[model samples]
Target chain A: MFRLEVRSSTPTWFNFALPLLAIGATLILCSGLIALAGAGVLEAYGVMFTASLGDSYAITETMVRATPMIFTGLAVAVAFRAKFWNIGAEGQLLAGAVASCFVGAIPMPGPLAMVLMAVAGAAAGAAVALVPATLRVKFKVDDVVSSLLLNSVIYYALMALIEGPWKDSFSGYPISPPIEDSANFPVLLEGTRLHLGVVAALIAAPLIWFLIVRTTLGFRIRVTGENPEAARYGGIHVERVLISTALLSGALAGLAGVSEVGGVHFQVMSDISPGYGYSGIVVAMLARLNPLGVVPAAIFLAAVMTGAEAMSRATGVPAFLSDVIQGTALLAMLVALLFTAYRIRRVGVAR
Target chain B: MSAVFEQIFQVGFLAAIIRIATPLAFATLGEMFSERAGVLNLGIEGIMLLSAMTGFTAASLSGSLWLGVLAAVLTGMLMGALHALFTVVLGLSQHVCGIGVTLFSSGLAYFLYRLIFGQQSVPPNIKGFQTLPIPILSDIPVLGPAVFNQFALVYMAILAIPVAAFVLYRTPWGLSVRMVGENPRAADSAGVSVIATRFQAVILGGALMGLAGAFLSMAQFNAFTFGVVSGRGWVAIALVVFGRWDPWRSAGAALLFAFVDALQLRMQASGLGHIPYEAFLMLPFIFTIVAMAVMSRNAVAPSALLKPFRREER
Candidate 1:
């Protein structure tokens, strides 16, 4: 019989190979569902791949989709590095969208409006995140439940806005009015939806990576997460680090909403996000909490999301196969992480 | 405000509170059992959604409501086992794994549902549970109709509180669950199986959550809409904290939240105020957060709640 034994160290290739292996395993595992759906697995996956990454237009669409996840993935990666459980990224994202939308609606110079939107969105997100951090630090509240509950509170608030005052009075649709035309994020490519936010998201990843790898705050965050008591002993302000981490993380998530509002929809709505905040957790885990890894992870999920609809139409397989793949990828990645800590040893035959 | 109060004092209002609380109570109790065993099942939201779908499908297809409930409970047990396999057996991070379970289950539910039912303009629904009033209890005036006249699943939830209390506080297995949750190493030294007890507790918890799902789809909504379990599972999680993980208290928390919820519905129905309906929907969540802030100082979570037990670790 084989059993897991703690490993002293792992090889460097494990990092690169593990995620690929997990993704490969996830695809293979989900193939069973495709077969059950009475469709040829290969044909379905082909449809999915071609539909998501095939042409320039499709590629642009996927990039647009990946933008928010990139931001959120960074948010989660940052917070988790400090061992701060922040599940309210969804709420923060909404807060950002609302703030940015409010800013965008005010008639102003295009460049100025854009700048103000990002700042306001990020600030709003940081403010919402502050509540949980402050609660955890001062009131001894568990951040997990409090942060999670905030998502619903924010959601209802958003619904109230759109359904009430923000309602499109003419059509009676519960949608916020479009932002000033000048405030719309300029599309990067002609005839494609690729916006400035995509570029910003791409650049933000490496910048975040740098900050995490090369900064004093990053070191403190890492140390704090690894051992709070040790961090305290080492003269790191543990509680301060937590609050700082929360602000940074929340700001990143807020930018996700800002980009979506500024670059894509240009207005807020009830279904503004299709659970991108939760997807950030999946992306962060698959990245092993590495900010640089978040880009590819976000792209992978984006492709699945973009492709699922096409796959549904082509092979008649349910598009939710993408969702299942996301969950499986996360679980598989978590399992693969086991390799970093332990190895299987066969004790019976060794002697 | 007086009109709203008038709406609240009636037998109908009490009955509404029971209807709303039934599902929340089951879910809260389910989560409480899992947490008591030191496994926080963040998979709850997705589990309830999946269970609702499966239960509705079974009942609609077989023309048997009880069969739907059985299907839901089994679904919960299976998913719970899956969760246990990851967190308990592999000793993975409970937080991320729970989220994964939720995402996975919710995805599977949606995929299978679409494959089986196909997309239609109107969602398919089934004939749901009918309330069976308790004989002597129903004869009593206001409390009777509100508390006694409920579906079988609702009755089960009410009975489940005391039963859960007995099992948790009095039984040997219950002690083992508590032991594992609070101090696994000591329990292991005492020869109690931490792994097994935790698995059983989580599984039992999943079964109860399944009943909650069954209540939603088969009784309350009478259909498996995507929004059928909308945030109730999360609300239940909050209620567990509010109730301090005690069965009776958790059930009481459920009732209290239900009271707030029923009041919101009543106010909206009365159309007496200019307040947006969404404002009312936000109350339960805000209430929970505020309550947590107030009660957090005195409330203590199980020490081993998020910790994974590995005998080899120092």
Candidate 2:
């Protein structure tokens, strides 16, 4: 019988390779599931890959799909670094989308209005986050529960707006009226859905990395996240750090919402996010909370989502296959990551 | 004033509240157990959705509600075990692992549901459990039908509250669980297996969560959709805080939410188009946050909650 013992240190190469191993394991497990779903496993994989990244058109759409994810991923990565646990990014994103809808509907100079949309979206996101952050800091309320609960409230509020005040009477649907043309993100690619939001997402990674790596605020946040008690003793205002982190996290998530509306959807509705906020958590974890790593992680997840649709269309499998794969990847990566810090070695016989 | 009283005092409305609260009661009790044993299973939403799907599908195929219930319970247990694998065995972060479980369960449920039942113009339904009315109690005025008459699972759920309380407070096993949650190192020194106790607590809690899902599919709605569970699981987390981890209080909290929910449904049915229905929908969730904020200060969670136990270190 093999008994497991923990090692103090693991090989550095294995640290980087673990994510690949987790992905490979997830793919293998999902292939079995696909086979059970009655599709040829290799063929399904083929469709998923080709549809997401094979051609320039496909790759462009994948980037479009990745844009919001990049924003939300960075948003979550920021919060998790400080151990803030802002699960309400979903709610924050919705709030931003609502604010953007209002600002985008305004008749103003195109560039000015677009800038205002981003600003308003960020402000609203931060405002929505304020409730949970304040409660967590002042009252010691469980941020996770509070943040999670807010998602439902924010969701219904959006529903009320779309179904009541913002309803597009001309469209015969519950969606909001289309935003003014001035608010639309300038197209980046000739015929594809690619827009300036991709550029925004690209700019976000380096900016966030700079903030985390080069700034005084970043140093304080890192100190607070690692050991609040020690930080307090070190004269760092831990609560202030927490509150600031929460606000910034919400702002990033809010940007994801603005981009979705201005760049991708153009009109606000309830289903504006296909779990981008939740997927952000996955992306953050996959990148190990490194702001710069969120870029590739977001794109990888976006490709999986894009490919799931194509795989479903081609092989008659459900599009939800991506959810399973994503979820499995998250769990597998977590388990695999353990080996990076502590390797399991065989010990004495099992008790 | 008379009309307002009449609107609030209907026996049928009260019965709806009872029916709605039953599943929440089950989930709250389940979560309470896990929290007491020092784990936060955020996978409640995903577990409910997956179990609901499994329960609905099994019932539709074999035409046996009991088997469907069993299947759902089994699924919940598996999820609980999966959570334990991450949080207990591997000593990973509870929050991430719980969320991961939820994602996996929701995804798998959706995929399986789609594969087993192709896209239909209208979703298929199941033959749900019939309501059971107790002998003389169900015949009495307003209180009779509301309290004494319900689906079989509702009775079990209500009964489980007292039983759970008894098991937790009176049994030696319960003592060990509480001890482990409060101080795992101490529990280990006292000869209790922290790993085993945590596993039991999580698995038991998960079974109840599964039962809650089964109740929703096999009794409450008779149909499983993506939105069937919604955020009821999250609401259960709130109830745990509102109840302060006490079984009886938790049941009361669950009923309170259900009353608000049922009232909203009734208000919508009354054709009061003047009022925004979304406001009514938002009421329960808003009430949860307010209640939690007000109650959380006094609420005492298990000291070891969210902290993975390592005997060798401390």
Candidate 3:
């Protein structure tokens, strides 16, 4: 009943249509899950979409949530494009947050202090990544394991810091002291949580696109990712490029940490991030590791995260359902993307 | 000096380490099977977490720890089957599949925990499994009590080491599994059902993972918390690589992790502790990375570990 179709490569239209198809499938599946959770799919979706976009305040909150995801998604995308799996972005983000916390606690001029803190945050995130990168380059260690283990260390370290030396004595809370006003990112809109981090991320998206498309380094990266032996034959420094890209990727993730601390929370807490690093993987994958595509993907993820609370409060559905949806979407996207590249060929006549 | 020896010689401390190491050892051994079969199951953390929650809930409801353990194992098997369906049958990326599984399971576990337990501040507690000391060995000094005095699950975990080692090395089935991991085409050529073997291994590994989760809830804590599994699954993953896919060696690596864990808890409890507990808490992770860096030089991962094995014609 089905006709055989042959095409040399996937067209641009197919590329755009694939994500749409994945989303359509995701929404239908999620609706079923929502109904299973004892909520009307329409009502649940209404509350979610409305609460996330109905008001200016809601939009700002969505942006605030999305800011770090943008950086993290880009971070993951950069490494993924280079065929390097840096699963340690969560740890690196924490490293940046911890480092910025240290910097923010220091007394200095406001603008200058903020700049220095961002730099330190980036450096700390990159430094934590160095362990995995160095091991991958020197000992051929799998970055996946090293990076994943580093997350546990970072988590414990943050926990220890908040519970001990960095504890907020005045408030009797397990949170770090608030950053100095000078170290805070200026809010972009009055009376809203949106801040300069959004601008930074926006600027970064285009810059990343440019770097990957218009530079000599980009050529090396694409060549290496496509074929390592071929890239080496072409006289590219494969190891150096991989290491530098990894560092750059980690720095972006660290900057996301800075955004959380400087532009949103103004202080580090044990729960500073709600697993944004992990969620970033979905964003990166959904965007197909295209840097420019990461923006909208991140925003969509942020919208889901932001709306989860409302969904929980209104429908009595746990907000974690959003996580399930995000994860399902990622799985669906991966499957769909795979099908796009390869199709199963029947060896025998149809029965 | 004798007092120092006496203090260090307490059977309780050593027994506690063994107890703690049991689940980690089980999970690490399980991961070794999957990794050796050429799939990196990062969903281990999620699998353990979900199984822990399900086992705890089931045990609390049924008032039977054994039933609870069974439920956990079944849940783990379900997750493993799901993973196999996605990664093997559907041919999805293992890493993404793992992350998706983790997210889905974690969310499901958390939601179910809230739905069943309600919004109570204090968590519910249940009767935990008691220790079953070997009668004859209980009377012996040092090694006897240390090895003999443990929960039923602990003994099972200990037995699993040799069983796993035997299956992995001395058996033809083990050779087929290794061949699938190293070269699927060759395995397929030799009449080994690559997909079937991989699916079997993944599910088998998943069952052990579930048992490990059950041990945490039914034996170790007698309570369930959101963070019960913590990062133990990640530690298990590291142990797999560090152990070089050998069950005994992986178990040894697991014991080292337990030592660090036990030492941290002990240091936290000790009044004479010098370092911040955070520093101590970070020790295992830091050491894991450093050790991986050092040992990875000569380490040989399974040739097909993270790569999807597609038939050449595709």
Candidate 4:
């Protein structure tokens, strides 16, 4: 039998190398599926990698896709850093979208209206997040279950809004009416759908890093996540820090919702988010829960999704193949990371 | 008072509640077993999805409901083994790996379903499990049919409560599971194999989750949709917490939630467009969160719920 022995310390270079290795392994694994699906492996890979980054327009589209992921990924990373599993980012993003939609539908000056939409979106997301956070802190409820359950509830609620009160008048479909021109995000590039939301994500990355690394709140949050009892003993208000982190996390996720509405969709729809909130969890994990690392991680995932779309159109392969890659990549990464901390050795007796 | 009682207890009201609660009961019991053994398998959701599709596909092809059910259970066990490999052997984080399992399984199921079924205008259906009424017992007034006449899976779901309770408390394996969950180091010192026990518990629990999913597609609906198992798996997770990780209490909570869920549906039907159906849909989840809030205050999770145990760590 082989037994795994824990390493005293993993080398620094190895820590960075594992992600690249995992990506390679994921590609090889996915290639097998592609072959089974009767798609040309090289052609599919070519479309996935180059199509998304092949041209200026494609890059902007990729950024548009990455925008929400950046916020949601940062949201997950922030909460995870403090050991809070904010799995309800999906719900929070919906709430943000709901608020942004309601605010944007009102006729007003475009600039002021857009500002209000973002604020409302963030506030609404934070408020929804606090529900589970408060329950966990005050009533000892498991945040994981509550937050996850809330996602379903929020999705249904969004559906109710679109299907009933806010149903699109012209199409008679389950979609909210289009936002006022004033509320629409300004296109960042002349010919691309890239919007102000991308800028927000770019700004948020460093701001989140500073919050986690430099602020007193960051110290308390890190301590609480590492050891709540020790944080309490060391004069940190662990509950308060956790609650605040939850709020910040929700707010970031909410910003993702606002970005989607103001930047891309321009209206709340039934299928507003294609599991972006859940995908954020993967992004955070891939980035190893580092706030700054989440930026590149979100971009990478966004590229995969964008490429999957191009691949599907190009090869007739189902777009969900991207989900397969994302999910499997996480498992592969986990095993690769495991080897970094431990090594397999022959045990009992050399047979 | 008679009229009020009659209105609240319509002809098929009790039956509807039981039918709705069956899947949840199975899932809740399954989750409880895993949690009791110190592994919280969030893969319950994805397992349900995988089994739903597999059971539906197998039943439709073979025209045998039993075979479909078996296929679902096997698929669930396979996913469970994967989960066990991560949490029990690799000692990875429970929630992360569980979520990963869910994503992988659900994605795989969806991909396969789409690949095989493609985009059909009308989704295919199969001959589902027929109701098996207990003789004499099923004929006893309103109580008789509601309680005794149900799918075989429903009867098994109910039986699972006591059987699970017995195995967890009465059997030697039960003691080992409890010991491992509460304190793995101590359990290891006492000659219990923590990894083996956890693996068995997770796989067993996963099979039940498969049953729950099969119950939806192969027994209740007779057809499968992407939304067939929607939110029920998460409800099971909440029920386990609300039930305080006890099989009996978990069953009771599942029944109660189902009752409320049935009532909400009835109310929606009666209200006839006055109340948003979504509000009614939200009832079970909202109630679950509230129940967890109240129940969690007094109920503690298993001591080693998410902790990975290593014999040499101490």
Question: Which candidate's DockQ is highest?
Answer: 2
lDDT of 2 at A119: 97
Candidate 1 vs candidate 4: the TM-score winner is: 1
Where model 4 places Cα greater than 4 Å from the true spot, the runs are: A1-15, A343-351, B1-8
Task: Give the DockQ of candidate 4.
Answer: 0.75
Give the per-residue lDDT digits (tens) of candidate 2, residues A84-159: 8888889999999989978999999989989999999999999888888888888788898899999999999999
TM-score of 3: 0.95
Candidate 1 collision pairs: none
Tens digits of per-residue lDDT, candidate 2, B100-142, equal 9999999999999999998888888998999889999898988
lDDT of 1: 0.92
User: Residue B299: error of model 2 in Å?
Assistant: 1.2
Pick by TM-score: which candidate is best?
A: 1
Q: Which 10-residue window of candidate 2 chain A scores lowest in summed lDDT?
A: A341-350
Please report, as a residue range, the 10-residue window in candidate 2 chain B with the lowest summed lDDT.
B1-10
Each prediction's whole-model lDDT (CA): 0.92, 0.90, 0.85, 0.89
Candidates ranked by DockQ, best first? 2, 1, 4, 3
Give the interface RMSD of each candidate.
1.0, 0.7, 1.5, 1.0
Instruction: Sort the candidates on lDDT, descending order.
Output: 1, 2, 4, 3
User: How much is A210 displaced in model 1, in angstroms?
Assistant: 1.2
Each model's TM-score for chain A is: 0.97, 0.95, 0.94, 0.94
Candidate 3 lDDT over residue span A1-351, tens digit each: 442333357767766677767777887987876776788988898899888887889988888888899999988888887777888889889989988878987989888878888899899888887778888989888887788888888888888888888899989899999988877889878989789889898889889878888898777777877898998998998999888888888998999999899888888898898888888898898888888888888888888887888988999887877887787778778877865776556556577
Which candidate tops lDDT? 1
TM for candidate 4 is: 0.96
CA RMSD of all predictions:
1.3, 1.9, 2.3, 2.2
Give model 2's DockQ, 2 decimals.
Answer: 0.88
